[model samples]
Target: MIEILELTELPRAKAAGALVADILQTMRSRAAVGTNLLDIDEWTKAMIVEAGAESCYVDYAPSFGRGPFGHYICTSVNDAVLHGRPHDYTLADGDLLSLDLAVSLGGLVADSAISFVVGDARPAESLAMIDATERALSAGIAAAGPGARIGDISHAIGSVLGEAGYPINTEFGGHGVGSTMHQDPHVSNKGRPGRGYKLRPGLLLALEPWVMADTAELVTDTDGWTLKSATGCRTAHSEHTIAITEDGAEILTLPNHS
Candidate 1:
């Protein structure tokens, strides 16, 4: 369902965004060379409860995923790009890690993702992948505003990824997010501008731009949660929940410390 939030709801959205941003920052800081992915999930769980917030992922049962995500956050390491369920593996140096989180606070929801290398790792390829996703996310948000169409955002994001020589995947992309984690108005990573839903004030969207290094295909892990690249290529994902306003699109989930 599409939820066009009222102007007053924006503050609640920011609260939710802050909670998500703060938790992600905390988790990334605590993550070390030997930290396990499951541990990160546990840490996030405590913070969510402490904030009096609810996890949108734990009970998330979408058609594309198995019912009840059964995790507090998504921990994608290296080849694992999207929906990386917390497991028993410990992180190693130079591992490209991605954390995707969403929560509901004050009856509003916010989502965000961050990709970083663990420990003192300086892999050029990994950094480039993360940079590309961040750049694509910026392009998408820049194209969003009142009266702007969803396609415009998609086109802007796609152009960035295409220019970087990465293939676009439409199977899973950005979507409306508000009172709930996932909502209507699926915003593909690639599309034609002025061909889809028109933007309006009070509308919130999570414009995520993710890509695999060598292919657009994704494979589900045995856990029925983690989505990895078909070619086992490294991947990266960047996202932010944005609200359309009179001035332009306002990003709600930027890191509080950044």
Candidate 2:
């Protein structure tokens, strides 16, 4: 469903977005060598409960994944890209970790994701990949505003990633988000400008730009949820939730440290 928040709903949306951003930043700070993936999930659960927020992932039964995600956050490691179910694996030095989170507060939901190195060892390739996604995310947000088409944002995102020589995957991308987590219209990472749904004030969108180092093909892990690169190359993903407004797009999920 495509949900357009009323003006009154904007405050709730902002609060939800802030919670998501703060939690993600805290998790990033806590994640380091020897930290177990499951621990991150537990930490996220506790924070969400403390904030009086509902997890959009736990009890989620989407067709693409096994019923009931049963996890508070997605922990994609190294080659893993999307739908990364938290597991017992411990992080290692230089491990590239991606955390995706969504939650609802005051009846509104916000979603965001971040990719970073786990420890002091920052591989050049991993650093570059992370930077590319962040740049693409910024480009996408800059392209969004009232009267703009969804394709404009997609094109802006794609141009950045394409210029950086990364393959794009369309199977999973950004989407409309509001009261619930995932909604329509689907926003692919790449598309032609001036096509697709036109932007309108009060609409919320989650714009994510993810890329694999070598190939766009993905292989699901045995857990039936985590998506990894087919070639086993390192990957990175960046995302943010934004609200359409009269002047332009207002980013809601920026980290407090930013």
Candidate 3:
């Protein structure tokens, strides 16, 4: 299921990526104390409809998830990390919120995620965890380019989180993304460089680096979708979709409004 966009198709990929990034950033801005997670999902749905784009989540029934993900965006709170299904929970001060979004436009799909603190209570641990994931994401992107191997990106990401004293989880990591959401060439957060699929132009990869504050173990919530830290420690996730090109890895998921 690995998809490589032709040079002519890259423009559509960029458009889809920009839409996803913009929506995620918009959701981040709207999320605050007292904000309902379900409300976030609604907002995302509205934006997708207005843009004439399709949500890669809704109707998404992967083997790992419950049924059709019926939600437009993933709203992960403090302890939650990935596949965070939007619920009726209300955000609170100091709550660490992570939003993961994917949208398909012009027949191409792009995915990205961001972690931040809601409200004014800046918890030091949460901020540190968020920073670590962000830094690792940047390192992973830097390691990606034509002629590079998938392990190079993984090693680059792992080096950052490992040095920051965070445990890495490989069960769910980055993967190839294109016309559909998740694709092949699974990219682990930590691995040996020079050991995986060799990169090339036109290849699109969603590089995400996520970490838990204390342990690598994850426990699924009762909702059968949200993945949380086993120890209930705070977690952070950062991701972006990049397209490998002749110039290097072009980050397509950057917010156009930023």
lDDT of 2 by residue, 172-217 (tens): 9999999889999899999999999999999999999999999999
Cα lDDT of model 1 by residue, 152-258, tens digit? 99999999999999998999999998877888999999999888999999999999999999999999999888999999999999999999999999999888654
Alpha carbon deviation, residue 247, candidate 1 (Å): 0.7
Model 1: what TM-score? 0.98
The lowest-lDDT stretch of 10 consecutive residues in candidate 3 is 249-258
lDDT (tens digit, per residue) of candidate 3 on 122-207: 89999999999999999999999999999999999999999999999999999999888899989999999998899989999999
| Residue 88 displacement (Å), model 3 | 0.7
Off by over 4 Å in 3: none
Quantify all predictions' global Cα lDDT against the true fold: 0.93, 0.96, 0.93
Q: Estimate each model's TM-score.
A: 0.98, 0.99, 0.98
Ranking, lDDT, top scorer first: 2, 3, 1
Q: 55 in model 2: Cα distance from truth in Å? A: 0.4
Backbone clashes in model 3, listed as residue pairs: none
